[model samples]
Target: MSDTHAPTTRLNKRMAELGLCSRREADEWIARGWVRVDGRVAGIGVQVAPGARIDIDPAARGHQQEQVTILLHKPVGYVSGQAEDGYQPAAALVQARSHWRGDASRQRFSPGQLRGLAPAGRLDIDSTGLLVLTQDGRVARRLIGEDSTVEKEYLVRVAWGEATVGVQPLVPPAALAKLRHGLSLDGRPLKPARVDWQNPEQLRFVLTEGRKRQIRRMCELVGLKVMGLKRVRIGAVTLGQLPLGQWRYLGPDERF
Candidate 1:
């Protein structure tokens, strides 16, 4: 059987404004037969009147739609979200002229009144770099949520491995330098890390995996302990010229 009755206005828009759910949510409810107009099962995308009655099941409004997104130039030691019994949350640092001091718009920072908005991805307390926080459910799902494909890039200062280990007395330093240049301690010869030697003292490490203290652990494995590690970029967004301990809004299309 098909619905022959028609409503005066769009079911989705009316339901959204009336029930405070977003348009996308209203559509989902209609498709699942969870929304009713005048006690009749509403069809998806149907028009309904503003004065007409609209109903929605409470469960359909997932909190994801209302989430807020924030990007922070986190300094070391701050936790990404909720404070532990002792630590402070990273969101506390979202301030004006502090994080985005040099940004073009020169907007002012104010407290976000929305509750439940939180960090989407985590940078360890010991590490300082770019951190993203969100109130949007989709952003959370895209970042820390399972199946995230975003890439995080970091800058690291490491010991020069070429001079440390390789051929010994029997072999000349030239041969040892050549042999050591490509070798790494990661079980299989490490995949060619996108490395750019900044100087004799530093090397850049760009990686895709987000393991626990991954960069530090990887550096330890290669015999060069990390002197410093700072995340400079994530996906296409860079922590360029942004000051530390501050945050700003992530514009649309700024995906990692």
Candidate 2:
């Protein structure tokens, strides 16, 4: 029996895998007659062999360049996505008036910029600090895709608690060590995390994965209750001095 297989893939998936653009972006380009395969404009749902050459029109490239990423200093009480339980999404805070005046990026705020913008990663409603929102699908995939490894840093304030039997008031060194490498949640072992003390009452956590309420749940296992949690950084970007409830453009030179 032969082990060989066809060397072709969907054009949109190929483009996304190549980091050129996302599948949706590729579809948009295809609809606009802006994508070419082997020097001919490709149609939607087109598939190409591995050796096929793909090119994007300059117009599509320019339009992609105009897509924006935003860094928001999300305040507690806003959901990361659509409104839930009567709380508005963090995206609601991204109006012209909410744009940070100190933003170094010269792109002026416009209502059009908000169209199709969505959160790349989630920040819990009870948590506060840096939350990323973007109109670029490539950015979204890079930050939250299944294979994404970007680090998200948080400062979590905790209190000693007596909730679980046999748990201590002060987290022991052994438990802290477990937090760094030996913890499981939802029946799966969590990825190794960087956990350490930022202050007596706070823990600094650097995790490459974002599970729902992960930090709070992790602390619970070690006999601590999270009193407050704030995300401060994602990848190479930091919250910096961006005021709470304000947002700013991700500058041209900035990369994840």
Candidate 3:
């Protein structure tokens, strides 16, 4: 008989919660006998207590090491994730010829790398700048997971009121203050952001959260209209001098 009152969770879910790997990968590892619980080989569908010791085999580590993460200087008009409404997904540009000539990683482009490549976060079709696509589940969870605290920085060009051309407009002090701290989107209060003017027409926005069209909606609420938006940095990685529409592998030494 089992002690039904004890708390338990699926092994895969516990591994994911501990940042070991995604649930799918955990299942595969368990099937291959690459995952162990309390020094015993764990099987698929196993349930584990909170204090169970979990370990992964060396083969699993090597498999994870081979997974690639790519950084792209996304151009406007490309959807960040999947193709929709006839717009191409940013992943479509990860071909051999499109690899940045300035890439120093020396990683050869391979079609096999595209097998499971997916964007970690989103950049709207109309926005441009740094975009991350990866085959590694760990990297994906690190950047887009619910508890991620990575900072994404953007340059936003905006126009006050209705005029977009030949007009220099300043953001009202009150509106700018609200932009930095107080605001709500989709009926929930937003986390504080680091927003300030980069120039007369552009604002620098550093946010830790990526809600759909969050910046654009936030600007609209403050009476400013976004004319252009470009993500310049995510975590410690910047778009750098990578030309538009080109990509490079995230170097082994790089983190987040």
Each prediction's number of clashing residue pairs: 12, 0, 0
Q: If the candidates were sorted by their TM-score against the true structure, best first, what order would they fall in?
A: 3, 2, 1
The residue ranges of model 1 lying beyond 4 angstroms of the native Cα positions read 1-67, 96-101, 104-110, 160-196
Which whole-number lDDT from 0 to 100 does residue 148 have in model 1? 59
Query: TM-score per candidate, in order?
Result: 0.59, 0.93, 0.94
Span of 10 residues, lowest total lDDT, candidate 3 = 163-172
Tens-digit lDDT string for candidate 2 (102-186): 9999999888888889999999999999999998999999999889999999998887764333333367898788889888999
Per residue, candidate 3 scores C-alpha lDDT tens digits across 1-256 of 3344679999999999998988878888899999988899998899988888898999999988888999999999999988999999999999999999999997899999998899999999999999999988788888999999999999999988766653235566889999998999989999999998887788899999999999999999989899999999999999999999999999988887
TM-score pick, better of 1 and 3? 3
* Structure candidate 3, residue pairs in collision: none
* lDDT (C-alpha, whole model) for all candidates: 0.63, 0.89, 0.91
Candidate achieving the largest TM-score:
3
- Candidates 1 and 2: which is better by TM-score? 2
